[model samples]
Target chain A: MKREIPLFLTAVIGAIVLAGFFVPHPYVSVPADYLQRCAVIVVAFGYALGGANLVQVNLEGILRRHPDWPYKLVLLAGMGVTLVFGLFVDRAKFQDPGTVSLWIYDHVYVPMNSTMFALLALFIASAAFRAFRVRSAEAALLAVSALVVMIGRVPLGDAVMAGVFDHPGLPEWMRHLRLEPLQQWIMDWPQNAAKRAILIGAAMGVMATGLRVILGIERSYLGGSD
Target chain B: MTISTDFGVWIAALLTLCVFSFLYKDNPLYKFAEHLFVGVSAGYYIALNYWTVVDQYLVIPLRAAFDGSQAGGPFQAQMQDYRGWLIVPAVLGVLLFTRLFTRLSWMSRWSLAVVMGVFAGLKTTGFAQGDLVAQVQASLVPLWIPGDLWGSLNAILFTVGLVTSLLFFFYSREHKGVLGGVSRVGVWFLMISFGAGYGYTVMSRISLLIGRFQFLLVDWLHVR
Candidate 1:
């Protein structure tokens, strides 16, 4: 019953919601809506479960004197401080400016988030030199496309083009030689088509997967137990 | 000549520097900031979820239902009626914690099953309606525009790209001769898409990096 019950629950719930889309009756719609709400509540519990697991894992690591235990200690301390400020305080204080939560958010989280993403710029440049090498026609196309986009979409590209080529002495085509229009054409036609094709294929894939799950054929989510 | 007087600015500046120090090498400062980030993020989200979902959806509805303390006039009757049904989900939500115990872990599957089922069902119809149908519908543009050569060419190119790209994903049939060539064109289009995407990403990230530098120099150091 342990396994059967949940599997039955899956099939039943999935059928109800899927039916609601076609049937549009209150019996299906109402139950589907209720199931969705339950899912939200359940998901919130899942988040709390995740947070607890993180705390537990970190605590265990520190207890065992694992590698970077001090960092783990610092991690727990940050969580504790943030939680105390977020949860133990009054609602007004928690949400208001100058609060400890807000202070940490502003000073710590914002800076870290910004800097972390900003570091990606450096990493991407390093990666481009490594990954964007041209050894074949395909590779060359990719590299050229990237270069065109990099130059076309940015201000620096305009300045470089205008400085070097944008002269009255140059031929009309050469004078009007701009990366932006070429980039735009590439984006509007092929890029957009690729995106739409992927979307359509993925939608079909999702439907198939959903059906598989509802049929209980995809039991990967259930784990190996019973 | 002047450093900022605000302690928050000092903290933000130092943290930003600590993160930037990563460009040199992964060091203690970056590790510290990274760990702190994960922990603080968890706590922040947990608290936010408590306020937004748990409190708003489950707790408040259940609390008011039990306590009989809702301001009632027109919508009160409907509000009070459905509030009682929330107990079912509240019980299910509690079931998710059973996984923390080995013996009780299997029970958590009950809650997970519901979550999986609802999402799968919703997404099945959602993707079909929102993505597949919508995209295919939008792709059906006029291929031959009179007196608009470029427009016609663009439309035709779009149709060919879309068809060929979809064919590239068709694995049931062997790709040979004509199919092989078409799929090869699809591959090129996909490569262009990826290249453009990467280029766009690099530029945005660089812009953000510039913003960080401006903050350090112009905002903090007064040296800009």
Candidate 2:
């Protein structure tokens, strides 16, 4: 009964929402809109549930004096402080610029997030240098293309092209062969075509997966052994 | 060379350095910063959603429905009218907490089922109309432009590349002869595209690094 009820609900709800797109009547559309809003509310609860889980797990870790308990303490402290400030002091305008919550976000959160992504710059450079060796025809083509695009998209490459093209005796053909123009051409034709192809295939895959889920053929999300 | 007087800028710089310290080695500073980031962000999101979704949508409406106050907003009016129906979702949301209890965990499946079903339905039509139909329409390019050889060549190349790439993904038959050659060409196009993508990604990451450097130098240190 448990399994059957959930599956039936999934099929029925899925069908009704999908039908809402085609059926513009107030009866269908209004309910569909309400369902979507309800989904958002449920999702918000899910996030709060996740936050609760984090606190629970970390508090347990700290109490048990597990390895790296100090970090857990820090995490719990940060969450507690932010939650207090946000829920009480700045509840009405927590998002306002001068609020304590906003202050923490702008200073601590923004820097941490940006720095984390910025680290990718150094890692990518090191990784590309190590991995971009030309071992075969395909690898060679890839390396050359990457190198060309990398250089062509940057100002240094444009400066070099400008210097060469603006020489006193430079030909018209040489002027037309600038890095930026070549990069644009490559992006416009070959890159765009490949991207479109991938997008189309991905869209097909999404449709198939959505159908499977709606039909309850994909029940992995239901959790438990099954 | 003079540091700024702003304490917040100093805090930001120190935290940025703490995160960047991971590049040198895993240390307590990085660990502290990482944990703090996750916890604070979670709290922020929880607060944001409480105000935006729970308090605004659910709590306020339920309150208005109970008090019979017409002073509340538009959503409150709707909820007051359908207050009975609104109880269903509130119950479903409360059921999600049943996951914490072992025996009652199965009840949470109803909530998950509704969420997944609604999302799957929305996404199916969204992808079909927006991505599938739209993309296919875009691929129908006029290959024979009257005056522009460059445009015509580009069109032809684009069409050929798109077809070959699609064929490459087609695993129905054995790619042994003509299909093999075409698929190989498709792979070349894909590789080139991926390379460009990687290059673009690298450029953006570098730009982010530059932004951080600018923050440190200009904002914190008052460097020109």
Angstrom error at residue A196, model 1: 1.4
- In order, the B-chain TM-scores come to 0.91, 0.90
DockQ-derived CAPRI band for the predicted complex in model 2: medium
Which 10-residue window in model 1 chain B sums to the lowest lDDT? B73-82
Off by over 4 Å in 1: A90-93, A169-176, B69-81
The residue pairs found clashing in candidate 1 are: none
For each candidate, give the interface RMSD after superposing the true interface residues on Cα.
1.7, 1.8
Best by DockQ: 1
Query: At residue A86, what lDDT does model 1 achieve?
Result: 84
Please compute DockQ, using alpha carbons, for every candidate against the native two-chain complex.
0.69, 0.66
Instruction: Please report how far candidate 1 places residue B172 from its true position, in Å.
Output: 0.7
Residue B39, candidate 1: Cα error in Å is: 0.5
In lDDT terms, how accurate is model 1? 0.84
